[model samples]
Target: MSNLDSKLPELMRQATEDLEPESVDLVERSVAQGTRLRQRRSVLAGTAAGVAVLATLGVVVGAVQHFDRDGQAAPAGSLAVGPSATPKPSLPSKAPSGPVATSPSANLKDPTLTTLKSLLQGPSRTFSMPENWGGKDDGFFGASWVVDDGKGGSRVEVLLERFKGPARCAGEPGCRTRPDGSTIRSESLSPEYSDARQKEFGIVSSHVEITRKDGRRISVASYNGVSEKGTKHTRVAPILTVAQLTKLADSQAWQFPAKVSK
Candidate 1:
């Protein structure tokens, strides 16, 4: 007979002999409980083994599926499956073409001259003219709107006037007399000056004489200093020859003072 069947009979005989009449019932119940416990333990062990095998198989299947999708060979203990793979396309190496121009004048309209005129009429906030409407004068043959730094901080000016012969030095105190005995003094001033001299005049000047290509000579001078509220103003002179000045006078870039009416 089978080993398990033989053991069960011997166990039952031992139980019957060892137990009293009342205790025999309790012993039988105990033996039945032990048999149930052994059966449950065997079922649990079998379930654990099945789970381990399934987990190993799942891993192998997944590895094979990945290899098939990538067009590679399936490794041992695995099966390949899925769609065929293709190499990805490369990108272009050069820049795309379109409009290539970038200079300021490329897309802009002409008559920047007229635009300059408007700017001069309503000079920027930074450029404040003298209270007496000093910008207009008969002495100035022509003028052009240069630029202002907008914070009342800096400015550039260009003016043209007819050569009224030569300038005399009588009005200015520091004017030097030339050896020619002519009252014509070089308008150039020394860079170094005493504190007393600077305090007397609210500005500094740099002067030079330039002869135009047409044989007309003119004096060019620059005046720079602080204005009201400590704003800096710079005035440049003799920007053009008398003939050139006349032409610029008609240009749109020139603006006469409002008070002057022309």
Candidate 2:
């Protein structure tokens, strides 16, 4: 017998040993269905091959058109002729126009304005003056300036205070009081304007405010990405200081309104 015929009995024996009785019957039905499906697919493939051969011959005969040396069709002109050229691509449409208005402050490029924007946008923390009603440990409004070093590091905060007192150190032991009953302390940051000494730092932006109970308004001037010496990258400091002084001088909150000398 041929090799397939010889293996058929062994294959049947293995299948009977490996599969359950119900599974063996199911597999026999599946083999019969698969054989029918393969025969149908072969018949369909033959029909498609014959149709493709006929269609190719029809296209070859139909597409042939006689043309003169000038590329013009012959007198018969049976075949459909395509246009000589294709259309060009179109451009995008233009946007609609509207009225243009000038900015209210055309001088936004002013050095002072630019410096103020930089200070406000700098990486710094918010600061406010501590409330003072004679009951608080320090009878002064406090302000803090936060600075960030270039590297990933902790921020340095510089605290400033303004109060109704002399140059005495209140936090120090055995500190003396002023003649007017107020404590002797380091003179206010801006001593000339006692009424709004705290508000001196508000020049960079009008939005800054001082609302503590001591009637002392505190303002803050902050710098960022600075060194410990406060000298390197010092451009931001002087600008912020000058702006705060200017704002304090211009504010209505000052006790003695003084003109900015510079």
Candidate 3:
């Protein structure tokens, strides 16, 4: 008892000597540390949510830039400068002012008697001068021909002379105006020759008279007889019809006589 009691006192004394009051408040420190940890966790969560929102906005902007109004992908150079940009307008072209030019006719040049003869219808043709016409004395241009086309011989004549007034029918009917302001008078004449032989032969004539736009008169006549005042007729009708005589009168082959100034 004495040994045990003495060791117990010494152990109690040593334990009491080592024991002291705590410098910090343990419960308050624990609460403060927990509050700081909660604040750090809230900051990290907010940062992650902000980064996710930024990534989603970037994806939307990229998609809008790649597409066009029709929702299709845009070509390189065909893209618009901006969403609200407008396109430019186009303009129209101009037209010409003056009248178009045209080529002159070959018939406008001078023509020869051979050229006239070539225009005649017959295979075998013979030309003759009715008189000393187309001279400075008469100032006329004319020719007569006997054309035989295997049917019979017939007389054809053409005459050109200066005329002053507007064309008239002179009581003979069937006068008409052509498109180019020329006038035409066409007729068929009964036998009026006084020659007994011509009367016996029974002559007929087709006559065409044309007044040109320049006031020149052209007369074309065809006879069933060999000549207008000749003896014999070889055809029932004139070799040239009234239509043919009109065409021959209308030809530009004749050289126009120069105007004589008074």
By lDDT, who's the top model here?
A: 3
TM-score computed on alpha carbons, candidate 1: 0.22
Going through the candidates in the order shown, the clash numbers are: 1, 5, 0
lDDT of 3 at 3: 95
Candidate 3, residue 6: Cα displacement in angstroms equals 99
CA lDDT of each prediction against the hidden true structure:
0.37, 0.34, 0.62
- Which candidate number would show the highest TM-score if scored against the true structure? 3
Model 2 pairs in collision: 166-185, 167-185, 168-184, 168-185, 198-217
In Å, residue 167's CA in model 1 sits off its true spot by 14
Q: Write the per-residue lDDT of candidate 3 for residues 136-231, one digit (tens) a residue.
A: 355555555567776777777666676566654455446677788887876775463444544576777777778887777777778887765535
153-206 in candidate 1: lDDT tens per residue? 222123333333453455655344445333322333222133444445434333
Model 1's lDDT to the true fold?
Answer: 0.37
TM-score against truth, every candidate: 0.22, 0.19, 0.49
| lDDT-best of 2 and 3 | 3
Off by over 4 Å in 3: 1-115, 121-132, 168-172, 194-199, 258-262
By lDDT, the better pick of 1 and 2 is 1
Q: 223-257 in candidate 2: lDDT tens per residue?
A: 32232222233222222443453343234432311
